[model samples]
Target chain A: MYELTKVIKDYHRGREVVHALAGVDLDITDGEWLAIQGPTGHGKSTLLQMLGGLDRPTSGSVVLEGKDLAGLRESEITAIRANAIGFIFQTFNLIPTLSAQENVEAALVPLGVSTADRRAMAASALEGVGLGDRLRHLPSQLSGGQQQRVAIARALVKEPMVLLADEPTGNLDEETRDDLMALLEDLWRELRLTMVIVTHDSAVARRAQRIAVMRAGKLAIKQDTRPAPAA
Target chain B: MFATYLRRELRRRSRQVVLIALGLALGVGLVITVTAASTGVKNAQAAVLHSLYGVGTDITVTQAPAAGTGGPGGFGFGLNRGTRTRPAPGTKFTSDRLNPGQLAPLADSAVTKIARLNGVAAATGSLTLTDVSISGTIPSFGGSAGASGGSASGGTPGSGGRGFITPNVFGVAGVNLTQGAIGPLSSGKITAGRTFTSADASANVAVVDANYAAQHKLKVGSTVAIGGSTGKSTSFTVIGLVSTASGSGSDVYIPLLRAQQLSGLTGKVNTIYVAAASATEIGGVSKQISTVLPKATVTTASSLAGQVTGSLASAASLANSLGRWLAIAVLVAAFALAVLLTISAVSRRVREFGTLKALGWRSRRVVGQVMGESLLVGLIGGIVGIGLGLVGASLVNAFTQPLTAAVGPTTGSATPGGSRVFGGAGQFGGSPGAGPGSAFRRLASSQTVTVHLTADVTATVIIAAVLLAILGGLIAGGFGSWRAARLRPAAALAKIA
Candidate 1:
């Protein structure tokens, strides 16, 4: 599902250049779950953003299904993000004015789904996340765990091929975080979704099929947790 | 989705919406009130002008009196002085004369020439004359049976005389019998009987003003004796009673031919009233008439509007200058405030907008949402503003007083001496105690008309005001949308709030 080689990302912070992603590359197969672990400001989120086509690399190529996301036009990149990729933020950035069902429906809006179909799909997605009863509740009215469930429902409503999560359970308690991780693992295995999760918790990283440790803007090591498929 | 999002967002910021709407409402309301007032003042001026300048008359042509020819030429009593045959003291003498005072007469052919000029639709001539009657008893001189007299041209009182003099004065206008659409009587409405007809061109007929008729206790078909320039009285049948607005116009109206014959200035007229075929051709026609009659003073309506004075003129100036500028200033401030507040609201919604963008919403869609919200606010403001504007206009019409407009010479020096035909008594050989009547006082060349000002809010003005409000909304929305459109989703989502 993805092939990246020698990707580099830079940022300008008041006349000083910060190499957020320096000469890093990795490849992942279809339906694979990969977790990137790093300290704060160590380019883990930056690399995740590049893989999701949310940010452009300064140099090198990030290939997704034989197309370089780094070299694609702005409109083409936007379409790819709309149709193929879903994002989950630590803050669960739900529109304050929209309800849980509406927030999930917003993901389907870009796909031009009819209103009735969009409502049905959003409700089903929320139910799958165990949020069927919170469909009409605003984000402010829901607890942190419920809000994250809503965010997860919003991300998976459009059935994107790839799901990129940046510290999805960072703002939740330990119990809620463990439950959210279990739910994410179940969804990944059931739907065969290519999931890339960035987290600082070693326990969250241990659940992935493979783990890559990013240090000082470079990928330092990669470890495979599951045995080779009995070949 | 658009409507839901917009409604929710507006509800969240209801206070800001109301504030912007009130600002816009104040601006629009003031604009409507000022515009209505300006229209009212303009209408009042037109009414005054119509009364003095005559209806449908686009231009007037008159000649200034020659340097020495404007005065009341000698009365010519021709009394013999220091003669034994002279009349004894205590004898009574009476004299009455009708003549064009302080006005130079143009040849009757001048009117014909002007009528034939290019761009001239119609032309008619009029003679404005004053009839003065003086009667007094001969004074008794001490130790003398007969009085010594030179030519009694000035009506000077004899030394040591005990007699008194009385003077009666009134205005008369000679109107064209065939052309009644372009003269003084054109503005008058016939209240009784009928106006002059073609057959009455040479007949001894007269039309009396309603106010003048009421004062003299006269009616239609009554006989009024008018003294001519020859000091001979001719009894004219009063055929009509005409009422003029604001009690303006001559006391009596007679056929032009009869007035010419009676005044003994045959084939001469003091005033020429001309009408143009179209309003747009008034200036050209005035120029043509001036060329045709070089010595005549050609005055157009626009030029006459500049000469108007009094409270009505002041109101017009205020409404046009200060009121207009103030409305514009307030409207501009409102627009600026709306724009600033809308931009601030958009800035506060950066995270929300970024989330939508990440959901694959295009930049245009985000900008459109912001514009829709701003435009809705503007529409609300426009509706409220219209209501407030109508109420303001009503208040203006209810409380405004009747405005008076004076049109003529603005200064005493600019006033032609001949225009003062109805001067104070004793200044023109009249009694010191006797003065002109109220009707004659209003007949002065300088005219003042009292008109009740009305603020008429027409449909066109309302439509334009609405369009202006919409435009204000568009402008504010445009700026806010531009700011929204420039936001990059990646950078916007990275914001803390």
Candidate 2:
């Protein structure tokens, strides 16, 4: 679950300041497939980073589970990130030095898992992504789609409270993107995972339960186009 | 954890680690070798001094000339002529020096009571001159430790050839016997038919050194022709010969009245020998004796020893000071090189470390892993340095003689014959024969020596050298990783270029 109350962020150098995020108010619920769509430099990544506690906000509060992120110490925030959060980057950021299985296992290092158990869990996560045989392959050795698949396995392995993927298939081909969308949907249905994926693709947006458009660092109204027959 | 960080750091920068170790090793090794060689030199000098001056021969009492100025010490003007193995009150540092006669009581009434005091050893008398010789019934009392030309490396006659000898003679006052019986009729105590008894105080008899006897080829029962300061000549029978070295023996032993007759002085003795019972009592007794003879200075053996030791200590201190600073400077340079190289290597792995950090690894643990490897590098460096030092010390000593030569605050000229008191080889490098180049070459060659390095001394060397090497390596790793941890993931990603 993610919640923010009037979040603002900025960066400064010498005598100049750049307001990356002017004011943003947004909220998302559990198991909600929400898409925050925006053009480049509209505070999309900044918002994601603030929500993930990777960056601090200059003003206002970003809350999760009724606790303000600003109030947590860096170490406490690190613990939260270790146990509750998982991220997917645009480039499929797997450690180059580690094998595919170890890339997944890297996430478990903070969880205080034993090495043997972590390796086992990583293997299981890879199998879930349907690349169990490619455990020993490096990120450089894997195709873009397969690399993203390994990224997804690493994210899912932690069984986190939320999956925050910035650009999961941004680098994939159209066909690969389509396949990734299907895989994501199957995983969402099977695991009932609460995932917030930011994307500019209409096809990807159509699969989400709700799509919230962002304009100039502020959230616009959410559009829920799922079939109304259930109501 | 710190060790682990060090270890990782060392593993990561193996080349830098090895280089730093080497720099430190060379620095420490040089210091050790030089220090040992210098120490050896000081010991040898002290040995030679012991033989010349005897066990406690710190001060010598010579009478002021009947007229004419010598120096402020009433001994002589030449720095090479006085008895200053120890520094006088005015000296900057201690060394083998003979203080001037300014500190002494020239009058005889001043010292008579001191001889009777407790702890007083036999107070013998002696005479020294800038130029003088003896030829009486001189015993062949040649001392082997003197300028025997034996300690020389080549074992051949030096270019200087056979040394010339002067034949001027003088009579002397006799001291009562204490230590040993004479073994021959030499200038030293006679171990023969007889010493002139008080009954025969005026008897025309004489003794001589064995070497002196050999020089003039005189045997016991033979007669010798002697000369005086005033061209006085007298022939006396060689009644006995003493077994002392060449310098320690005397040419003639007659009653004080007879000496007055031969030297053309009514009843004047030129020198006095002041001996105390034990070494400890010498200091106090010497001071008390000086009070009576306000014109003559009195000194103990220890003061002379201190003067010699202090001069060497000064040299050592100077050398060590420069060495310590040099070691630190070199170590600093090594550290900087290591740190820069390590940072360069670790910078390439920034993202990897960030990933590790994001995985909840503590910064300290990472630092430890990096630093652990540095200590291993330091150990290797220390071993190399110690080995080098040993090799240097041994090689230097083996080719050359021990560096321990007579070092002193005193500039007084020493007689070669007096060096026999050390009972070992006399002082090396003291004669005019060995020049600086020869000394230097000797040091470069085999300077092998028997140095008893006690545990404490060894400990001091190791602690000083090894600690320096280890500290140098660890600083290199610590500087690199701390910078990587502060990067924000987004900024870090952006700054990866």
lDDT at B122, model 1: 95
Total clashes in model 2, counting residue pairs 3 or more apart in sequence or in different chains: 114
Computed on alpha carbons, the lDDT of every model, listed in order, comes to 0.78, 0.55
- Candidate 2 retains true contacts at a fraction of 0.28
Docking class of 1: medium
Given candidate 2, what's the lDDT at residue B229? 34
TM-score of 2: 0.59
C-alpha RMSD (angstroms) for model 1: 4.5
Q: TM-score for every candidate vs. truth?
A: 0.89, 0.59
Off by over 4 Å in 2: A91-104, A130-156, A170-191, A198-208, A211-215, A221-231, B1-133, B136-325, B369-460, B495-497
How does residue A9 of candidate 2 score in lDDT? Answer: 86
Candidate 1 has an interface RMSD (Å) of 2.3
